[model samples]
Target: MVVRIFGISIVVTVISLVVAYLYGGVEALILCAILGIFEVSLSFDNAVINATVLRRMSEFWQKMFLTIGILIAVFGMRLVFPLAVVWITAGLNPVKALDVALNPPADGGEFFPDGSPSYETALTAAHPQIASFGGMFLMMLFLNFIFSQREITWLSWLERPLGRAGKLDQLAVVVASISLIVAAEFLTDEANRSTVLLAGLLGIVTYIAVDGLGSMFEVDEDDIDEAAASSGGGPSQLAVVTGKAGFFLFLYLEVLDASFSFDGVIGAFAITSDPIIIALGLGFIGAMFVRSITIFLVRKGTLDDYVYLEHGAHWAIGALAVILLVSLKWHVNEIITGLIGVVLIAAAFISSLVRNKRLAPEADAEVEKSTPVS
Candidate 1:
């Protein structure tokens, strides 16, 4: 399974190298490899969270994720989305933005000869908007997930209280809104303040809207049973309905992917301002590996085995959200961002190992009791 999964990564690496070599010789190839690794490291938690959702999806939907979803991830989020942002924020047409992105000036200057902002410069200027939106969206996701009712918790001390607070309807929204307003008013620059605030508010609205839609469309077990009875459908047919219930989940996953990609797209500029390299390196290679990891986790039931994995992933997400917000005002090293997630995930994994060890005896005893007395 590992070989099967990483086989594609190998292929992607080779293709990326070949393209990079053709683009600018050894230096470009090396940079592309580094960028791919950077993306993978940064997005490990994304893979884990994706697995949690992917496991709930139907086989058809899972296949869609690998096929159709990858295209969206690679092209839509990596290439078009960034271009759209440059278009909207920099006051350039799509053609102009694409041209500037593809051909950044030699001096890495902010402007072209015609006095228009370069694509890289425009993208840098638009950071506040991207950061605010992605940060708030991710913050709400973490807040809502942590605040929701759950039987198992990795961080019981904090998560339990949050879960209790979640009983107050729309508490996540209230918290997110407050956070956004505070960041915009206090932390943001006076010039970009309105854009930041608006983007943040829009992010919150987006989260609420997407979540509400998911809830509205989600299929209940009772509804499935009732439908089966009415239609004289058997267990297999009921299972099919249950599987198809993942339609909303599929949508949620795609939105989640977009949210995560925001950071990756922005961060890619640190390596090279070239949009094509960013798309190929992070979008194609890194994202493909992430998808493979997600599929691996689902097929192996890794979440069930490592119970705290989801908890750790969410905690990492919360940290990343906070970092994204902070980055609007302060420069944060990508290394710091990556390490915090890696450490938290590692701790949660170690804790899971300990928990399983403690639970093993109890499980064995229960199994023995259930067995026939030979």
Candidate 2:
């Protein structure tokens, strides 16, 4: 099972590194390795969150996610995304955009390089809109999770109050709207303010549409009974869905992937502007690990075992959203962004170990009681 899950990622890693070394010698190989490390470190939370969704999907959909979805994640975001940004911002056609991205001009200024704005510059120019969109989309996810009813709480002192406050109608929307407004009003310059606001509103709308539609169309499929039993169910951890409902859920995952990629790709550029190198590192290596990790977690039931892992991942998401919004005005180090998730997740993992230990004796006693005079 482990080999089945991670085989592609391992294959991708070796091939990508070989390609990287060939493309730019040992230096590129080293940089590619570093970027791969960065992406995995920064997006471990992504795996945890993705596992939550993957478990709810059917076997067919899950396979598609790991296969077709991996392709989309690798090439779509890593290759096409930056190219599209450059195409639009640099006034180049698609072909021209690809060409320019592949061959950045040698005119050496900062990002622009004393020449017409390079692909890197165009991408940087588009950051405010990108950040606003991705940040709000992510913020909505975090807010929705944090403000909902859950069986467990990792940080009771904090989550308890937030959950209580969530009782109000549309509180998540209200909070997310206020956050968008705050980012626009204080963070963005007047010239970009309207664009930022529009992007954020679109983010919110996209979330509502995808999530709401998925929920509305979901019906208990034939296999839901098995899913429910396996989950030891109160209403089932897995929602059996097919057709449009399933498609919407799939769409939600992709959009969520895009939101995460906005930063991950940018961080890759910070190391080197070569699109091919970025693809080798961030796409093939890093993204492969992320998806494989999601599969591993689902199969191993790791999230269920480590109860607070989901909570920590969501909190890290919340922090990332804040950082994105803050970065609209000021610089936030990518290392700091990556470390935030790592630290929160680590703390949560340790806390879960402690919690399991505390419950062990009680569980043993209950088992003894149930055993009776056997």
Candidate 3:
């Protein structure tokens, strides 16, 4: 499995190096490697969530995720999304935007080059809009998780209260809306406040639409039971084709993947302005690694083994959401964003270990009692 996961990584790296050498020699090759690492480190939590969703899906959809999904992730989000941002925010057509992205104007090493800004400049200028949209979507996703009434919880002290609050219908929407207003009013520049607010609202709408669609198509217990009965007397791990429900879920996952990549895409500019370099280095190499990680977690059932892993991933997402919003006003270190997730997951893992240790004794005693002198 390890080899399978990394086989693509090795191939991607080699291709990246070849592309880099063709484009800009050894320097571009090194940049590609670094960007790949950057994407993987920042997106570990994304893999966890993808696994959580992927495990529910049928084998066909799962295969689609690895095949067609990879193209959408690498090119659509990493390359085209950035171009779209430039085109929409800067009043350039897609073709022109693509051109500018490929050949950014010489900055003379200036952060904000003067007069008719380069592709990076235009894209970076749209950061407020991008951050607001992605941040709000992610914020809603996190709040919905915490507010959900669940049997298992890692941070019960906080989660329990939130879960209760979730009883208020559309509470996640309310919280997200308020958060967006606050961000626009206080955290964003006056010139871009409307843009931020609009983008943020669209983000909320997007999430609501996707989530509502998923709920509408969700397989009911009766349906699952019917499927089970058709097969045999009892429930079985059958690959029940969910059809429409499954397809919507795939859409949801794709949107979710986009939300996670927003910050990474913006942050890539901090490294270089060449869109090709960004796509090849981070999109091709790094995004592939993230995909492999998702496959690994799903195949291995790692989430089941580590009981609190899901909780940790959601917490990390919550942190990332908050960071994305805060980044509107402040320059957050990418490393910090990545580390927060790593630390939370590590802590949750330790907590799971302690929990298992405590439960083990009870299980042993129950087994001994049942043995009855056997």
Best by TM-score: 1
- Over 280-305, each residue of candidate 3 has an lDDT whose tens digit, in order, gives 97788888988888989888888888
Q: In model 2, which range of ten residues has the least summed lDDT?
A: 107-116
TM-score result, candidate 2: 0.93
Best by lDDT: 2
For residues 141-239, what per-residue lDDT tens digits would candidate 1 score against the true structure? 899899898999998998899899899998988999889988888889899899999989988888888777666656666887787887787777666
Worst 10 residues of 1 by lDDT: 237-246
Q: All candidates' TM-scores? A: 0.95, 0.93, 0.92
* Ordering by TM-score: 1, 2, 3
CA lDDT, candidate 2, residue 280: 89
The CA lDDT of each predicted structure is 0.86, 0.89, 0.86
Model 1 bad stretches (over 4 Å): 234-245
Q: Cα RMSDs of all predictions?
A: 2.0, 4.1, 3.1
Candidate 2 segments exceeding 4 Å error = 110-115, 219-241
**What is residue 103's positional error in candidate 1, in angstroms?**
1.6
lDDT of 2 by residue, 1-374 (tens): 99998998899899989999999999999999998999999899999999988887778788888888988998999998899899988888999788778777765444444355777878999999999999999999999998887779999998989998999989999999999999999999999999999999999999988889888867666556766777787453564346556677788899998898889888777899999999889999999999999999999999989999999999999999999999999988899999999999999999999999999999999999899694
